[model samples]
Target: MGPLLLVVVVFLGFSVPPYLTFDPSLSRLPPPPGNHVYYPLLVAHVLFGTVAMVTACFQIWPAFRNNHRRGHRLTGRIYVFAGVLPAGLLGLYIGWHTAAGPSVRVANLVGSALWLVVTAIGLRAARQRRYGDHRRWMTRSFALTMSIVLSRVVNTVAMIVLMPQVDTTFLGSAELMRYSAASIGPWLSPLLLLLLADWLLERRKPGAARPA
Candidate 1:
């Protein structure tokens, strides 16, 4: 089920780039309060988001496969260099420039920090040869990576649920739903994914809790 969901997510992750282009002007707050960093920050956001999503998809194969080969190590190194580092930096930058309320900004900041921490812990655990710890931390990191996918899912659901009662046009309703999704989506998605991953991991390998 997880793999199936991940396949659907990967399809959407790849599909979104063609259908949606970032418009800097759309990020600006109206009239008196304008966020100057909005456009550049959004550009950075898209850049790093693409990096993170693509690389993250490659990071989990070893967990599902029997062969933990040199290629896995090389890919993991690349993922850390190409995905995790840039994601942490860009996420914090974009979070600072977020146009929404403080709550949204704070949530994003927390998520970004947690992403960095989990990635760092995972790497450190691997270096120390604590395979179980490494697995748990990597699971946490991947869960964070799924935030982008889950955010879209939440937005789609919100649009479906909220659109029918309103008289708004499809585009307007979608726009509103997107905003609602972005605001709260990042906050909830990572944590939810973490819990789900932990539950699944425990079920699959009850001895996964044992020390390596």
Candidate 2:
């Protein structure tokens, strides 16, 4: 978890500054041609997603959760309402309208939809006072929430492997190669994280108390 939090911090530190000025020119990925709303939406997504990432660290911290139950619940609410809710909603629109190519578009759509759904289920479990269910679902939610970081790692690695094949496999189109590599990470990262989350959950004794 410490490493995860550090990654989040480092990601935000590097990624958020350019957007702080609200300059479309500074966008990491240029918005699709003539999609005037894209930059604004990107800003919103990044801001709220930042909130989600930060709050999630606390939400999953065993020491924090154990020592401050009320803080845990409060942070959980903030994470859901202020973080994933807005970020996920914006992500759906961004995904649908992205210019990153069909593969990345599909990945964005699926990942955003799944993120929203998993988060909703987690919120529902908490509302019903099902701590165990809530913990399981939120664990999955956290995995999805943090998928962006892992996706970056995956994207970097994929780019490294795919770059050399661009002339043959990508037909000399760097754009295609870029988007294709970008696509794999979004789809693959969440799946890996969710599997890890479930595996961790399964290792626990049945009916065990929710993790602090």
Candidate 3:
């Protein structure tokens, strides 16, 4: 049920962008002050984001369902091929191109770096045939991958909360706060989940029995 909700949020977040006609150009670094590689970098970021979000929706399926058959294998391969690979590459590209400001750039770099690490760990765990480890790592990856949804949610909430505190007309300030929350908050969700999973796994291990 939770995974299904995550899928819905991710689908809506990614699907809305191309049609909105808003200036995604807001993300690009302006000329002279911006990196020469910015355009290619931004393009790569969007490409990977698209792929990652789509693929991430599938990563949770194996966890939710008991069927690990040929169909699962085929879909998993496609997910890795189309989603994880592009996401990792594009995440690295965007991380390197992160801006110099004391705001969104830091969050972007951190999110991208975390995504790369978690995704790589997921791949490695799968390679080692560690299904439990793989699931945990993939959970982390999906958590990071869903930053797009969280970011928007955070922004919307912020706008509503801050409406009474200041002039909500300042979309730029509101956006900055939203971006920060979205990028940073999502990281925490996975980290906490990883820690909890580890703790639970340890507790369930043999010889770790409680006195009760």
Poorly placed runs, candidate 1 (over 4 Å): 1-41, 63-65, 162-182, 207-212
Which candidate tops TM-score? 2
- For candidate 1, lDDT tens digit of each residue in 1-212? 47855674676566445324565434332212465654555555556666666566656765633375676666677667677777677778777666655667888888888888998999999899998898788888888877767866775676567666444644556555546545667777887899998887887686566545
How well is each residue in 1-212 modelled by candidate 2, as lDDT tens digits? 77877888899999899999999998987898878998999999999999999999999999999999999999999999999999999999988888778888888888888888988998999899988999999999999998998899999999999999989999999988898898989889999999999989987857767767
Q: Rate the local accuracy (lDDT) of all candidates.
A: 0.69, 0.91, 0.60
Per-residue alpha-carbon lDDT of model 3 for 1-212, expressed as tens digits? 57666666666565646524434455433323545665555555566566666656655664634665565556556556676666666665565555434455555667667777787888789889997787777776766666656555564565566555433544547555444444444345445545665676678667998968
Question: Arrange candidates by TM-score, highest first: which order?
Answer: 2, 1, 3
- Which candidate comes out best when scored by lDDT? 2
Residue pairs in steric clash, candidate 3? Answer: none
Better of 1 and 3 by lDDT: 1
Off by over 4 Å in 2: 207-212
Ranked by lDDT, the better of candidates 1 and 2 is 2
lDDT of 2: 0.91
RMSD of 2: 3.1
Please state every model's RMSD to the true fold in angstroms: 5.8, 3.1, 5.4
TM-score of 2: 0.94
The lDDT ranking, best first, is: 2, 1, 3
